[model samples]
Target: MPDDDYDDDRDDETRRPARRRRGPRNNTDVPCPECGARSVRPGPWPWYLGTIGAMVCRAVICEECGHEYDERKPHAHLPTRKRNLAIVINLLGFVGIVSVFVLLGVWIYFTMGRR
Candidate 1:
């Protein structure tokens, strides 16, 4: 009789330890954009380090839509402004050359008439 009680107590203690070690269940349910099915997987890390500890995120491409999005530093517009200024300077130089030729032609014509 005492042996039976000891066996019952041992079973209860083992079941209690099992219940205490129980963990929560994981639920990861998401649909995939490519096939419209529930088969989504974890994506890889996409980041790169630039100058001065600056990090840039890589592009995210959509498999279903075939679209790509890039992330980078924007280029400065100083080069374009310098090019426009050079064009304007060249245009002014051409106009000045034309004016000099016209003035020389008029000066020669007037001098020949005086002779």
Candidate 2:
């Protein structure tokens, strides 16, 4: 590629800065843990997965107090519960199926050889 074609200044205008959303932010006015002030701002989003669900939340930090809090705490226990139930039900079904086969083999062994 040509050197002039890859100019930094030309790409500067094309790359727009990320715009911060305007809204009634939750936990924004919460007091910081470090400074005990309400000058907290939204920080980067934290990604985590738990037994209940996957969690992704923007971190809030107090500018004056230096406290941090999570903004998103989506509950995912319903899906987790359903998944556990499905696994248990499937395991029971497999056990029942294997028992049926075993019973049939025993019955055949007792009846077929005598005849």
Candidate 3:
């Protein structure tokens, strides 16, 4: 009985640990735009990344209706104040560029005339 207990302990010590369970990888599930199915998957790799449509849009394919469309949400317009600020900044940049050119031209003319 003592030798049997020692042998059992040795077997337990040499036993491997249990394997772990893995979860899903890249399980991007969304509603299909065309068929309105709730099982939309991500588009194909590499080739899908190379297309112009991929650049300007989100690439997703509907498994139900086979419709490949941009998955991007409709863009919301900026507030009027923010739009006005952007326009003002753009005009200021233009004015600064023009002022730099005029100053350079005036300096060149004065320097050459003096020489």
Candidate 4:
């Protein structure tokens, strides 16, 4: 029972930071409203997109019947089709600009030789 016999290791110990654990908020096991089959998938975006938008929009789709739904309030659907159309239009615009520059370069190249 001597004070010197106890090592002061308790005071030297560093405090560990508290770890924040995330828990699942919704029950994913719930049956699909459209189809009673458990083949329904949960998450945002379609299954083809790998469900990346699950964080922004909690969406669900029933594979058995091709039914789509969102459980989260104020849910937003992905504008994939619109985005694709925009991309195509932008690409065409870019090609047109480049084509114009190429045409101008060719015109100058030929005209300068004559001058």
Candidate 5:
């Protein structure tokens, strides 16, 4: 019985500590547009034509003020200048991708289709 008690104490000393529970990783570092608290988290998915359409928009909510906004447009209500710039950048990227495809097609037509 004394040996069993000693073994139990040794086991407790060797046991690993419980890990700290981490919050959701999505948008956690972003500051809230309303209160500026860095506790933003991805909100519940929007219900449109059910779950299929919910994937279209990503809503981020502030834990401090309970303010929710689109992830792409991080401002409180309307889009900010930074948001507009992001939109322009995304559009330029899309245009560049399309132009690449068009150039590839033209090259293929001239090289293979002509022969």
Candidate 6:
């Protein structure tokens, strides 16, 4: 191998700067009820899973005072309810698919054994 083939062609000035990734943005529209600051952001989790509990509500957290609360009307829990319902439907679909594959395997084993 020749040493001339490994030489650098481009200069540092020609290279583009690396882009910075941004995290979740603050919800400027919704203000904190405790401190009344417009620094509310989305909660860690949207649904109830493990320790994170935001079920049946659009949970939000204020950056200024660290106050957490639901963004939607307290009485109207339709949106979050619908979200949970969708999750149930998806789980059922997964179960159905797995059951179908299991049935197919059983049928194949019985048919092949007779032959």
- Report, for every candidate in turn, its global Cα lDDT versus the true structure: 0.45, 0.54, 0.58, 0.56, 0.65, 0.62
Instruction: Say which candidate scores most in TM-score.
Output: 5
Count of backbone collisions within predicted model 1: 0
- Tens digit of per-residue lDDT, candidate 3, span 1-112: 9999999999998896877875433334455555666545665433422344345445566666766654563122223323444566567779999999999999999999
What's the TM-score of every candidate structure? 0.33, 0.34, 0.33, 0.33, 0.36, 0.34
Which residue ranges in model 6 land beyond 4 Å of their true spot? Answer: 1-76
User: Clashing residue pairs, candidate 4?
Assistant: none
What are the candidates' C-alpha RMSDs? 21.0, 10.6, 12.4, 10.7, 9.4, 11.4
Candidate 5 weakest ten by summed lDDT = 46-55
Question: Rank by lDDT, descending?
Answer: 5, 6, 3, 4, 2, 1
Candidate 1 CA-lDDT value = 0.45
Ranking by TM-score: 5, 6, 2, 4, 1, 3
| Residue range with the least summed lDDT across 10 consecutive positions in model 1 | 46-55
Output the lDDT of residue 9, model 3.
95
Candidate 6, 9-111: lDDT as tens digits? 3444357577888654565766666777766767655333333223435666677777766666423344565466568756877999999999999999999
lDDT value, residue 93 of candidate 5: 75
Candidate 3 at 21: error in angstroms? 25
Per-residue CA lDDT of candidate 2, range 2-58, in tens?
777777667886897878876533445445455555555765432222322223333
What would the per-residue lDDT of candidate 4 be over residues 1-115, giving only the tens digit for each residue?
5654454554445455668985423345555566554455554454533323444345666666766655453133436443454466567779999999999999999999995
Q: Residue 33 of model 1: what lDDT?
A: 34
For model 5, name the residue pairs that clash.
none
Residue 80, candidate 6: alpha-carbon lDDT: 60
Model 6 per-residue lDDT at 104: 100
- How many pairs collide in each candidate, listed in order? 0, 1, 0, 0, 0, 0
Candidate 1 lDDT over 2-114, as tens digits, reads: 99999999999887844466342222233233443332222233222222212332233334444332223112233343344456656777999999999999999999989
Candidate 2 error regions (>4 Å): 1-76
